[model samples]
Each structure stands twice: as structure tokens, then as C-alpha cells.
Target chain A: MSQKAHDIFFRSNAPVTVDEDKCIAHKGCTVCVEVCPMDLLAINPLTQKAYMQFDECWYCMPCETDCPTGAVKVEIPYLLR
Target chain B: MSLDNFLNLEQEYDIVVIGGGTAGPMAAIKAKERNPNLRILLLDKANVKRSGAISMGMDGLNNAVIPGHATPEQYTREITIANDGIVNQATVYAYAKHSFTTIEQLDRWGVKFEKDGTGDYAVKKVHHMGSYVLPMPEGHDIKKVLYRQLKRAKIAITNRIVSTRLLTDASGAVCGVLGFDCRSADFHIIKAKAVILCCGAAGRLGLPASGYLMGTYENPTNAGDGYAMAYHAGAELANLECFQINPLIKDYNGPACAYVTGPLGGYTANNKGNRFIECDYWSGQMMWEFYQELQGGNGPVFLKLDHLAEETIQTIEHILHSNERPSRGQFHANRNTDYRHKMVEMHISEIGFCSGHSASGVWVNERAETSVPGLYSAGDMAAVPHNYMLGAFTYGWFAGHSAADYVAGKEFSALDKEQIAREKQRVYAPLLREHGLPPAQVEYKLRRFVNDYLQPPKVTRKMELALERFDQIEEDIAQLKAANPHELMRAMEVAVIRDCAEMAARASLFRQESRWGLYHHRVDFPERDDANWFYHCHLKKDQSGRMVSHKREVEPYLIPLDDHERNAYDKLRLKAANG
Candidate 1:
């Protein structure tokens, strides 16, 4: 009766990262989040800064190119790298 | 978190273009040019600034059909032969005849093509029998050019909306589109007199061999949305059995791009650095040779650029790394494999349905009209053989003009309330579930099953098992839970992927022949059967809403090939010197 099936978390690095100091997310700019093809980047409510919320990075770098403040950097995922 | 559904939001457009990629933008622009008074809506799941197959931009046009380099007749003959005689020649001819016009249009629009000293289109010979590859050394700005045109035309743009299904009327013609925003989960209902679906290939149908889910040749956002949407709207899909399997850079899972580097002195080589095939143009027959070499004693295949001169290698690197998939350079650098010292490892990509590289997509006539009324298609999702990016633009032009004419005196068909409600429930079920399977897990499993079974050298039993497994996965689809709208978008994509998987299997089963080389190599029927199976295999949703497969006869050729030209692709394998 006590047998439980629960979820566990695995750690991996996010391929797309945003520099908080330059993000301008709190100042109301969402260009990096808006231009991402995969919709993987979002602004964290607590931090008021953009960040990658999913591991599904295609490494097709619109977030880096389209960013207004040059805040986003895309690295090839470890597996592919 | 409770779902923030945008139920009350509705829209109406005179003509709606469902993807803002290579084709959809052109469709909207040309439709406006046809009638500037018509209200057109250009929509996408991502920002139009960065979307579709050419999101990062294309390196070159795979099929250019320029004036002095190749005529429409020659290009048509080449495509007809490459596809093994199962082509809608009228459609290919239409694309061929107008190919130069489309190139001119792009050229005038500030998009550039490679030019000779005399200002002629510098078309290179990459195909087995024709010169079609037109390099775009500065082609990375294609999306920017399209975006400029879209804005100058004053077209309305909506981003982040994933269009899921088509809304049909009482007579079963597409009248509206139903979808949700991936970021906000807001519902969209767009009413129109005509609709065009340019939503690229079903690229995410099979799992890449690397076990990394996101690494696919086509952008992962494609995910078969247009193919599934067309089928549900009663549009016929042609040659789904002839799958798209490219020879990609091994673990990176992107194109090695022989089209660009082949003319520059690079070629596909085996482990011993010997050119096994005479031509590097991507064809099912060529892929078949590639698979043979990979399975042969030269087990690992590679892109051989090590012998190229230093200047040519630098030029190749600049073009390859800057356009299409820019991260390719990073991947090569991470592995520390320089093209000067070593060959780049290559492998066959997982299969999908793409009419751009191979002929498998929603059936569209020469006018770009689908079987269903008021519906049109172009791009990788539309069946026009090796249409590539230029074909997307050309067919997009056709769909736009055709839809503009079709909707001139047309009236909007009434939307069905019941259909909307049913789709709303289906779309939001995963978001409402308390706790269950995750969309990513389900998608990973489904695609892995696709790789295990439906990937070529087709075994009859394995495909049947794939259908059964796909049916089981539908149960898992129902149980899928999403914590947020972003996840919900992926959840809906999983549903579309499942539909495409089922279609791929059923269509492969109906073909019953080993044609297109490694693409549809049915083990039981191991040879090309022209007598019984020369027709194109089409799949669609029958009147009863059941999946059905039937053979559609290939249209009579507008340009017939000579005996020697017909078998050019078949003799691609280079014979040994002694033999």
C-alpha cells in the first residue's frame, strides 16, 4: 500500500543564457524571449530576468542575434559539442 | 496553476497565411499585390523575424533553374528522374518555368544570388544531370528581406501562435484556423475565405540517432503541424512513402551541405577517402548508396574537404559557418576535428516527410491548390519534389495569387461551434490534468519508436508494430500533463507528431515496393515494381474521418526525358578502376 512512484530531477546546463545585468527584462524588453523559435526562454518572476526554462535548445541562435542589449549567449549543448 | 485560456478572442481575415516562414511571407505579400484591399493575416508559432526552415537562413538554393544554366524542361526532367518517375510533372514544370521569375523577384527585393563576372546567375552543377545549386554567399539575410517586404506591404503579423487544426464548413472546405499561443495559451480563431498552409516539413517525426531530441535536420518547431492539419481538413498527401533521409554531420544531425561545398571541390567520401558516388546531390538513390557505403567495410562515411586548397577551405568555412546552422562551426571546434586535417564524420538523418528535399507532402496542383476547397499549400509541406527554398517562394507566389483570385467574390463560410468546443477541450486536456505523463517523455518515446520501426529498409512487421505502438501512444497523449503554456505547446506538437507517424506508417505500408532506393526499401518487395506500383501513394482522412491510403496516378510529363537521362541517377555509383 505504501509503494510510491514519484518524480525525480536530473541536472543539465541550459545552452542559452541571459546576462542579468544587461537583460533589460525588468525594464520591459522581451526581444530575446519573443524571437526564440522554440519558446524556451522566459523571464523568471522572482528574479525579473530572462532565463532558459527548457533544455530543448536547437542552438539556432535568434535569442543571441535578436537581443536588444546583447544579453543572450548561445552555447552548443554538451552532447552535440 | 489554472489555465488562462483566451476563449473570447476571435479574428477575421480575407486570406490567412498560417506560417510566416519562407513561403508564408511571400504568400501574404503576393496576395496583397494581387489585391491590396484584401486583409491578410501572417501567423506563426514563433516570431516571423525568426521562423521556418530558413529561420537562420539558407546557404544556397538547391533548385535554381536559371536561364543559361538550366531550362525549365531540363530541370523538370531532372526532378522527374530523381524521384524515380513518380512525380506530378505539371507541378514540377510549373515550378521550373517560373523559377527564374521568382529569382528575379528576390533579386529585386535585395536578396542576393551568386553572380558571374557578366552578372549572370552563377548556377553550379550539383544535381546528377543538371545545374541547379545557386550559392547565396550573403543569403543569411533572407528572413530580414522577407520581413521588410511583409512590413512594407503593411501585412498584419501575429507571433507565438501554434495553429493546430483547420475549420471546415458544411461541405468540408477549410474556412478558418484554430490554434493557441505557446507563451500565453491564448486560443485563436481566424475566419477567412481562403487559407494557405506553408508550415514546413514534418521534421520531428523520427528521433535523431544521437538520442538528443532537439537535434533534427529541419528546425524542431516544424513538427509536422501542416501535414497533420491538412490531413484533418481532408487534403490528400502525396508520396508519403518516399521519406526524406539526408546524409548529415554525424552527431550534430545537420546537413553536411554537399550542395554548397561539392562545387568547391569537397565530396562525400568513405573511411578510405574514396568518392563512392559520382554526384552529391541529395536523392533517395544517393542516400541508398550512402547507406551501402556506411554498412560496407568503410563503415563510417565522411565529408572530404581535407584535400581542398587553403583558400577554398577558408571560403567553405566562412559560408558554412555563417549561414543556415551557424553553431556547426562550434560543434566542429568542440570535437577539434579540422577539415584540413581530418574528414567530418557523416551519418544518415532520421526520416521525415519533406517535399523540399524529397517528394512527400500535401498534394498541391500546379496552381498550389489542395484537394480541399479554399485551401492552398506550398513549401516543404507541399508536394513539388525538390522544391527547396526558391520553390517555397515560387509556390508561395502561386498560392497567394490563386487564393487571391479564389476569394475575390467568395463569402466566409460559417464556423461550427461544436468543432471549436471539441478542439478547445482536446488542446487544454493536458493542462487541466492533475498529474500524469510529461509531454517531453511521451514525445521522446514516440520518436524513438519511429526510429526503431519506421526508419528505412522497411520490414513489413516492424511498420505494423509501429502502427500498433502509435495507437498505444495516443493513450499516453491523453494522459499527458503540462504545468505551463510552454509545455502545453509542446503537448499539442506531440499530438501532431503522432498523427504524422501514423500517416508515415500507413502510407509506407500501401506503397508495397522497394523504390526510391533506401527511402522505401520494403524487404519483401525488394525491387522497383513499375508494373504494379509506379503510381504515387497518397493518404488522407476519408469521409468517415478514418485514415485511408490510395494510389494516385502520376500526371503525364510536360517534358519527357530520353532513355539515357532517365537512368542518370541510377548509375551514380562510381565503378572501381580495375573492374
Candidate 2:
């Protein structure tokens, strides 16, 4: 059929990461997610652990600085690095 | 992400502040202080705890008007000359007069400014005529202090609502705000007696040269939202042609921070490591020299810090890395560049419209009131020339007190139901579409066109073509598809960028003479024509809703500048350099 549709997926390494061992998102603490200015961090529904859902990070580091248990780290995006 | 349950969430407030950044918090706090009984709501698209340009805090006040260091009259004169004499002296004078009080207020609130052993504000000479740059070695916790104050003031804050439109009554006065939640996609119908917009600069208007969408000098969250919101509500914006193009790190897209390093003896140098300009204060004239050197074969400029002592370099690294954009240290480390041995490379930033640095914003008077009746604006979005952080705080205070007095006996105006429905349909069309262009892709194309055609050394023909392209991008905005509320936010921001682009083209074309150096350097109109173009170029939406441009006569100078002071910026080239 001429009605074929396609989507392109671009892969990017999230500059921000959450150390799951220290992350307390499973205990209902959402400080990191709540404080991010770019709103890039979110908790995975299945794992209940915080992760970077989108690669559009400003690397502003509120997620890292505001984490209660020191679970997050912000790296310079690879493109700028 | 349907709007079914979110349709009935209507709330009322005496005053609504639309950003939680630098000025918005101050506005909210001051309004609450003016009358503690008033119901004020402070909101941001992101959490207010970490939002705006100072989300991570700033290194220092770029323009601090302290008592022992400089006088208000002197500071006002410096800004008047630096901005090439199109300033409303009354507004700048008001900020200068109240600058120290604002500093004292922030100091009392636990935000510290650097002081000498004698406990005076350690102001340094960065401007050609005066000493205004006051450092804050421990300014990293400014947001924490403001947050504490916000809590103490008992102001209500709603996070994650991206305000897309200002709701005005039949009498054409701003009465409320319309927005949606970025997470739940809840449509917000916030009715207020007065609305204050503290959205930061139009940082995302020009796509960065690195081709990265979020790579910008001003925080990427400041996508010209306030300017768009104010313009759509029929506010006059001044100096839109005076684009904000800064000398930033080559690819990092953050400030190398001339204000911080310059006071400690670091200077901007060419390939030969020769200082061309006498001062490191950011002015259009200084940028003109930098541009000349770049185009005149000494192409790449560098922040010359290698010659400084190791202790000085460490102090710079401590302040530059610890505050504002700490990831800057990592960017330098990745490139193997260190202040101890290697000079950092620098480039001109993509163009933007920010009154904080270069004086292009929604027009406001001495009281921070816009041309509209119940609308006010401050921060980078307010048109106060060379007003940096201190200006934002001062003007935010003005907007708060003035707005409090304005709504003293005022009642809430009726909300226009038709306007709310139309804006709702406009915001949600992207989410309802099955297939369309992505918001990010459309933004990239629009901003790349901005860099190509609108970056200065502007030609009349090229600017005309930019206007035509911007018209096409408006049509493209209707075809944007957002799968969720986050993408919906980006889609709305793209519309703001398009409005700013059109304003840039129209404002630049309206002013027929070159002024503000690289900011509005029209190649076709290569000289400053004070005889014909001395007046301020004001732009607004006319009665028919077309973007119209006009001229506003410059007010008579209160502190009159002599001939020598007027030409001070023109003679910035150092005499000792290669002489």
C-alpha cells in the first residue's frame, strides 16, 4: 500500500545519569526529578528507578546538586565535549 | 494527554507572576510584603526551586551600584553612553538610584556579595568610565536564599505550568493567564488582577553554531516566551533590532565570563595574544573591535589567562566552575585546555534579544509597568539598558510595589471565554495530529535561518528574505505534532521564536542606520544617522493584528553628557597595542 509510514530514531548517550544504588525514587523521593530545570529526568514505571528520558539536557546540574542521596551526576554533553 | 479533566481547573489571584527566575521570585516576595494579605501566585514551566538563569546561581553582580564604590548619576551616565544614547534616562536612573537598596535586601536575605577586609562591597572597574562589577565568590547559593525568602513570604507557587498566552478583557487589559502543565497536560485558566512576566531572554531564538538545539548562552528554557506572551497581549517592544550576540567559548556555548576573569587581569586577546580593547566590559564598541580582529586575519579570540599567576588561575577556576555553569570545567577538561597553560578559544554567540546585556525587551516605564494597563515585565525581558542581575532585582521590586498599589482597590476582570477556547485549541492541535513535523526539527530550521540571514553585518535584502522565510515558518508551526505535553511546550516555544524572528526583521529594517556595532550593524546603512534615526524604534501589534513598527522620540537626558563622554566608547582601542 502507498500508505506506508516510517519513523527515525536517533540514539544519544544521556549526559545525566542516576546511580540506582543511592537513588531513593523507589521510596517515593522525587527531588532530582522535581528540581531539574530542563525536566529531563523521570522514573521508569517498571524499575521505579530514575532515568534520563530525553537527551535534550542543558547539563545545568540541578538534578545532581539537588539529589538527596547523591544519586545523580551530570556530564558535559558529548557534542560539546 | 487529553484535556478532558483539566478543563475545569480555574483559580483566581490578586497578582500572578509567570516565572520563578531572577525577577519573578523578587516580584512575588515584594508583592506579598507590600500587602501580606494579597493572594499572589508564583509559577514556572519548571520547578521554581531550580529555574531561570540563576537556577544554578551566578558568580557575581555584573552591574552593582553600591554607595562607596559608585554613585547613581555616574552609573546612569555610563549606561547612557554604552547603549549609544537611546536609553530612557528615567528608567535607568530609577534602577541606579535603587540598586544599592536591592543589594542590601539580598544581603539581608543571606545572599552574600564579596567584601574587602574593611567590609565594603569590593567593586571593580570593568566599565570604561566607572567601577560597577561586584564579585560574589559565594554567590552559588543565591537561589537557595531566594527560595527561603519565598517560603517565608507564604506565596503560592505552582510549578510545571508553561504560560502560553496572556488573557485580556474586552477593554484590552491583561486580566489573567492561560497555560498547561508540562507533565499532566492540564489546561490552566489562572485569573489575576495583575500579571508580571519575568521570563528570561529570547536565548533560544538563534540556533547555536554547534547545531545543538539546547546549546545557547542564555538558559534554553528562556525561549522568548515572555516577549511573545507580552507582544500577543498588545505590548510595545523596544530595540528588537539590537540583537544580543556575545563572545562565548567556541563550542561550549557558555560564558567564558569576562566579568569574572577580567577583574583578575585576564583579557580578551587575538591569535598573537595582544589586547586590542582597553576594557573587558561587554559593550557594543568592545565587540566591534573583537569582530574587526576576527575578520582581519587574527580570526580566533582567546581569554588570555595563561600569563596570570597559578593562584589567580585557581581562583578563576573555583568561581567559574563552582557557580552558574559548573560543567564548564568538564568542557575545558575534555578539550585539554587549562587556564594555567592554554588560553580558551572564543567565538561570537548566535543572536538573541536580551535587555539584561544589550537592551532589547518589552517596553516598561520607571515603575516596571508595560504599555498595557495591568501588565508588567522585568528581568532580561524588561527594556532597561545594560541592567544585569541587580537591575532585575530592582525592577522586580518596582513591579511588585507598583502592581500591589495598582490592584489595591481593583477587582478581577471577567475572563474572555472565547479567547481561552481559541488558545486551548491552538496549544492542543499539535498533540491531536497523527503525523506532522517535530517541534525540534522546525525550531532547528528556523534558528539556522536566523543565523544565516539575521546575524549581523545584516543586508537589507537578506533581512527582507528572512521576513519571507519567517512567514513560511509560521505556517509550519500549525503542522507541528506533539505526542506529549513536553513536546507541546517545545511547539509553543517555536511559535514564540517565530514571533521574535519577525520582530527582529521588522525592527532591523525599520531603523535605517547602523548602530550598536555588531548588534545592528546594517551593511547597507553603515553609519549612525542621529539626525534621522536618533529616536527609539518601537514595535507592536497594530489594530489589525499586523506587526507594526514606529519611532519613539528619545527623552531629554537628565544627566547631560558632554562631547568627550559621548565619544568615550568609540575610542576603546588601546593606544599601547602595537603602537
Candidate 3:
């Protein structure tokens, strides 16, 4: 998809990771997978950590907003503009 | 990525307003109306067309205009009730009384509201107030109204842009702002008399959340830009706690807009499929009341929704005159569009949404002035006394008018050349090379902690654990070095994530009695402490970047509700009492 076609606020092929320190492992953070608009993140039930779906992402704040423990983060490439 | 773009920063303007949302645009319009010759520059990190609660086309406006459905007094009552009474009474009235006027002002600005078959403006919107929530329809499409005014004002609209930071004099009062063109990444300096920080509340997770197997992203640009700018410029911040949550978002997640649940008649249902609002501590009365249900073990509660009634869907279709998901009148589109029959299963499918139902921000005086001398905040950026954001309307009006006036009244001071050079170095320092911290790793951790742990109502111990974990995660932020513009922008997201964690920690630490919204579960202090804990747990920032807690007494506006309005609230309460 054209970058302009998507909301300028989001980025595709952006790096996605989770903070291990903040993860309480309540096992309730499944909303990320369920609501992944880009299908960018996956869960490793064995390791209990999420993996990235680098090929697809719309870069919205739902998963970040929904996390109860303040866990999710988003980093998009932006310049001085 | 190029040195050429760094040369894009220009030095001056007539007016520079910080945010580009409902309040910012309104402020820009107000300033233009006052001075046509003024060079007005309105900027946001994203396009103005898609920023803020209104621009995102979340839910319809909930203006407290009519005395019948919700008198300003009654509205204030509701706000105080929701806040457990910590709202500044004068602050509530200032915004509550003006909501009616704001609605009318929006109409005067040429934005159209949904009209009834009789061609009169509709007073009651569908699915509001009670089960229907059918109260006064306070117009629709806030973005349309503001946009019309912006165009008529002939204000320079820098839609896709960035509010990089603020420019201040040695004395530490705001002089202008630093911004960049979204497409070109061109640095633009907007010199103005006063600056208003309406860059709405922080929410960007520099990283994806760890715990959530997966979920939709919440806000794309709300990485606490206002808070960071204010803090860097030495502005006092407040209410870092009291973050909001639906508790039901995971149950029936879809649509990035808030209020999506309301129109769908979505409610919280526990693992047993029983309506948990009444059963759990959370009140089933308003949709927000469901937060208590899940917090109190009513969840792991999945949301239960009846899907749009087939004919109601058709009626919406008839009104919109199109078959699009968001009807031309997009007020309730989020609710009606998703054809999911069950709410719990819906959560398993779609991403999360946004709503003004809950959230906290910096504290502001009636003039919307922050603790900082020359800085001001409005809309979601300002820490409101309560959740209704009564001041968002008035505060925006005040901030724009006041900030413009402050600029007009002041004399322009020349840049201390040495200081300017120092600031320039600061801005580019991150771009020089790569720090040990990777942007993705920092972002990933920040996202997981905030969205997964902070938003849900878990136990005190679990919450404390979340807070401690956040502290350690934030440590990695310092090591993040931006090698390029994108990296710098994402690196700046650290400020946003830090503030998010601060607010979440505060929300967990305070509010021993989780009475309302998503903060309902309590293994420690398990019951509602209306007598002792019914006030707001406010947060202010310390010099150390840690949150300082304060208790704002929740006081009621003692005015009697209008006869008819009182009767309406009484009816709702009467049902509760009888039950």
C-alpha cells in the first residue's frame, strides 16, 4: 500500500517489540493478536512473548492503548520535518 | 535523513497554535476572527483531518445544552458523580454551561447536524443516555464543523505536520514552536506570541506490548507530545494517573474510535455469559460502568452485544443514503457497521477503539493555563477535573484567544545566538549516530506495559509489578540513539512512553477503592469506599520525571437539577434503587 494511502500516523515495516520488564504475564494481552489490524504481531505460547508480523501493519494505537500494564510501544521513522 | 531538510526550518509567523484537533482548530479560527492579518499556523504530528477524538470520527458530541435532557447543572452532577466529586466546581460550570453555546457555535460555523424527518435538528441521538442513551443529539461530526470554520478563517492549514517542540526565551515563556512538514520532513519554525499545547494525551507505545498475543493499535500520534514539550520547556504537569479503559474493549474490540460499544448495545458479560455489570462492582448503568465488572472478577468478562437490529440497520441505511459502513452521518457508524452477533467473539476478531470515556492529563486552571508560566493545555492534553472534559470546549476557546493575545501583547526578543546554537545541537544530537537501544525494542516494551497492564483493572500487587517493570523498561530509552529523522521521531516517542507508564503507575497506586470505569477489581480494598475514596486521584509531575499524587476533593455543584432533568436522572436512579 502507498504510504500516503494509510493514515500518516502509522508505518509499515516498522520494528515492533515488547518490554519484558513491564510484562506481568497476566496472559490477558491476547487483544493484540485478536485486533491486530496489520496482523503484525504473533504470540509464542511457549516463550510467552510476542513476535512481529513485519510484512503487514497499519500502525494504530489500539493495542498500545488497550494494554493495562502500559506495555505496548510504537516507533516510526520520522525526520526533523 | 538529509542535511538539506534541516535547512527547512523557517523563523516566523503571526500565530502558532500547538495542536491541530477540535480545540486547536477552534483556537486558530478564533484567533483569525480577531485578527485577519495575523499569520496563523496550526500543526499536528498527523494530518489535522485525522487527529484528536473528533477528527477520528469516534462518537457524536455529548454537549450539555438543553435543560430538559441534561441541564448544565445535571451534567455537572453526572461529571461529579463519575469523578466521585474531585472536579473543580467552577471548572465544571465554566465548560458545562458553554457546551450549549459551543453546540450552537458549531452550527453557526456551517457544519450540519443530523436532522429529523420534520427537518428540525434532532435532539436525541440513537443509542445514548440509557439503553438507547437517547439524549439530545449535540450535533454530529465535530471535524466537519471545525474544518468549515478553519477554511472560512482563511487560516494557513498545515495539515500533515509535526509539533516538534516549543521555542522559549531565556526567561522561560513560550515564544513559538518547532514543527516539520509531514511529507517533506522540512523543518519549519513558527514564531508566535503564545503557544497552546493541545497535542492530546500521550499513548504511543515505542514498542508493541509483550503480554497481548495481539491487539489493534490505539492512538497513533498520542505519544504525550504535549507533556514532553511542556516538560522540556519546564512546564509543570499533573494527573499522570487516572488513565482510562473500557474493560470491554478486549471483549468486543473493533473500530479504532471510542463509543463504538455504545451504539452496538454492547455490555460486559463474564465467563459464564451472565451480565456482570449488576453482579460485579461495576455499574451496568452506563457502558463505562462495565469497567468495574471485569476488574472485580466479573471478567475476564467478554462483551455481549445484540448486533444491530436488522431494521435499525436499514433505518440507518435510509438516513445515510449510502451503503458505507460509516453512514454519511457517522455518529453511530462504528457501532452499527460491524455485523458481529456476539461481543465476546468480536473481541477475538477486531482491533481496539478510542473513546473519551476515560483518560487523565495535565491539570489546568480555568483559563486552561498549566502550572507553567506561559504554557497552556486544552482538550485531552489538559488534565480535566473529570472525564466529561467540560473544559475541552471552553479551554480551547480560551487557550487560542489567550495565547494569541499573549503573543500580541509581548515584544519579540532576539535569539541569544549562543542559545540558539545550543538548542540546534540538542535537536540533532540523536541523529549523529546510533545509540545502543534500538527503536523497535524500546517501542515494543513501552507498548506492552502500557496497553496490557495499565489499562486493565488488575490486583494491587500485579499493578505494582507492572509499574516496577515499566521503570526498568524505561531505562533502555536513554540508550536509544537516533541515526536518522525517523529514528529521532521514534526516539522522541520515549518521552510519550515514559509519561504513559507514569500515568499508569499512578492510576494503580491511587484509587484504593476502584468504583468506576476500568479500575474496578480490588483484592486489597475490595469494596467501593464512597465515603472516603469518592474523590479524584490526581497526579502532577516532579522535577525527577516521577509522578506526584494529590487528592482533589470531589465536590458536587449543589444546584438543583431542573425539574424535568432531575426527573430523568431520578428515573435512572430509581431503577437502580428498585433493583
Q: DockQ winner among the candidates?
A: 2
Candidate 3 lDDT over B143-255, as tens digits, reads: 55676677778877665455666777777677767755533445666666667777765545323322222232334456667766776666644434444443323312223
lDDT of 3 at B65: 48
Interface RMSD of 2: 1.0
Candidate 3: global Cα-lDDT? 0.52
Interface RMSD, all models, one decimal each?
A: 1.0, 1.0, 14.6
Tens-place lDDT digits, model 3, residues A30-65:
655433333345566776765564432333444454
The per-candidate TM-score of the B chain, in the order shown, comes to 0.99, 0.99, 0.77
Q: Pick the candidate with the highest TM-score.
A: 2
Report iRMS (Å) of candidate 1.
1.0
Model 2, span A1-81: residue lDDT tens: 568345576789889898999999999989988988878889998989999988888888888888889999998888787
Residue B538 miss distance in model 1 (angstroms): 1.2
Which ranges of candidate 2 are over 4 A from the true structure?
A1-4, B1-6, B576-579
Model 2: lDDT equals 0.91
List, for all models, the DockQ compared with the true complex.
Answer: 0.77, 0.81, 0.03
RMSD of 3: 11.5
What clash count does candidate 2 reach? 0
Where does candidate 1 stray beyond 4 Å? A1-6, B1-6, B577-579
